[model samples]
Target: MSQVVFELQGKADAIKTESTLSAFIKNYPVLNGYTKRDFNLAPYWKIPTRKKEKISFETINITDSLKNGASFDDVLTSLEKGINRPFKNRKEHVAFCLITKGEKSYLAMTFDHLVFDARNAETFLDIFQEDFKGKKYDGSLNLKEPAHLSMWMEKFKAGQRVNRAFLKMADKIPPRVLPLSSGRKGFKFKILTFSKKESEAIAENAFSQAGYLMLMPYALSASVSAMHEIFAGRGDSGNYVIPVSIDTRKKEEVRRQFFFSNTSFFIFKVEAGLAARFPELLNSVKEQMYSQVKADLPGDICRASLLMRIAPPSILGSLLKIYLKGQIASFSFSYVGETAYESPYFMDNKIINMFHMPRVPVPPGIGIFFQKSKENLNVILSHLDGMLTDEESKKILSLLKSRLGVE
Candidate 1:
């Protein structure tokens, strides 16, 4: 019942530019949605005991001797290095890394999946920046001990609808081994930009025919179908499993008076017969998206029954650890909404980029496409080691554009 939780804290040394910092904070979702009790999913709901450690400035030992730049690669490397250390303090927190790398002049916070949704991650950054400047965060957020898994287990055993759905789904899913390698396996994340003009054109085309705005899920599914045709030689017609997260926080809130999130898998079938017509592919995706948005897990127990077979935290941790070093489910895709709650300000810096991770290492591949503007779209692709080549990806991208008649 304990959710997996990871905590790493550190501060970047660059003098705080309130403008730059504020812009970054605004890029995340939690600030608007968060309340005093809106803890990061992991910190609040994880099933394990919590842990904490305090390290002084000198202990972090980060130096600018090597090189410095705002390159995303460098930032990612630094964050990864800090998170490699095991958590020593297990009491008050069964997790790890409290004040992970404090006084380093940069703060890095990483959360385990059991908690911390897209919104929570953003809120944590907002709190971290405010705390760094010695400003009071009126939100009243705090480091909380993990919730008792036993309580969840009790409810789960009692046949709560969600738990029953999970149990049923777990029973039908055969053991699945993903083709995509975990992020820790040295998978580099690449940022692909789509202009607002281009996305609008695509969405317009889809809506003209389908009568609905094109969503990330639809774009993502189209991208996957195209990739499969290019790389796998297009003869395969079977269904490819794509995991989409359903924010079950509403259900959890009813029971515990707080938000609890659950992820469920959806099957996206490929029809090789329509290989020439990519628009139809996107149309198929829209249909699925429309149905999935309202499809309640509890009501459709048969489909739910099939998905639950994938191990929950306790089992996934063990099986995924060997092939992957850290974090399982690295390569998966979803579309979380993007919009600023209020105007963002930092030390005269404007926020230009917004990035969120896709479920890492979900067999075939994982791609997360997000709406960056009314028309612009941003997609982050995480592929398994040497699976989908650059040429392959490009072909898929072209298919999406040409088929959709996007600019």
Candidate 2:
């Protein structure tokens, strides 16, 4: 249980290999198409400071720990202990616990909410491991410049008609829906495993029938639907919003090195009847998802930054919050899907669980986290301890199985 600390003089080759950010962007289209200019959603440069300190430990070598059934816990503890100025940095950055199990060495990297979102995390891990073999870093620091917020603003200024339409749509949304909570909460982890065969089928059904090549959103929808059934049958208050994290990095943006991530709320407006007609419910879910994306598209956000006209960081943050709350849809799930998970080494401990902080006032929220192994999918839910009893959580999980038909 003792901790060892050391200074890591990263080899140029290793650093290059470790720099898997480019690979991450390539894997997830959701992340690839952004320029640094689109970072208005989540401004990394505007932050008061850049925290680049690293913490390293070498104790109970990873291989030994895994043999003793203490592998994951050791890595988790290190991550929980890592610290920085933001206070939440420990929970916001990815940590790698490299293990050398003879001929099979792997690294485990757990991403914090601050940078890598759920979907991007998985992509990062794969690229990370692939690059860790000491290959030359294929990425160029000379990436394209990010889209300037000012440019986007000019476009919007010339088009007030679009603004009016957006405002009109905003008026239709219900007020007092939900707000992100600023409360301190602990996360619980659950590991759900599926064999390769089962996972392939699930992916096939999701892509072929549902038209979603990625499993994260599909799984998220099913998870939300599950929670909905749980609350509805019990007659407990049933309002929920799904928070989806959006990456503001543009494809041609050089500042992709910077973190400018933002989260968008997706409302799951679940009704008891929708559950009865699963396909119709799914279509409604899909349509609503598209509309939410269209409503607050990244280009539009860049325009928003330009309209504000060189506003102070603090002011911009306030305006962003108001805009997010007003424009984001209502629902019970939060998604953070665009960030990287490059580990320092291969044979790293694979992350098996994740729980997103839920919006305040509401009793339940869900987040999806998957990893490089792809052998596990973690569905994290947070609710009033008393409101969502054990039985209720189990029931919700059961519903998820029936709906997704995952074996």
- Could you tell me the TM-score of candidate 2? 0.56
| Shift in Å, residue 160, candidate 1 | 13
Over the stretch 1-407, how does candidate 1's per-residue lDDT look in tens digits? 11111122334223333333444444333322322223333222332222112221112233443455234444444444433333333211112111212222333333444335544444444454455456645543333443333344434433354344333333122322234434454343444557767767766765666565455545565565555555347333233344454332332222231122334444443344543465676667666656644655333433323232333435543443332333233225555444221123221222333444333533435454443422345655555445566676566567655555663
| lDDT scores of the candidates, listed in order | 0.41, 0.42
Please, what's the RMSD in Å of model 2? Answer: 9.0
Provide the lDDT at 168 for model 1: 33
lDDT score, candidate 2, position 103: 33
- lDDT, candidate 1, at 333: 56
TM-score of each candidate?
A: 0.56, 0.56
lDDT of 1 at 370: 48
The prediction achieving the highest lDDT against the true structure is: 2
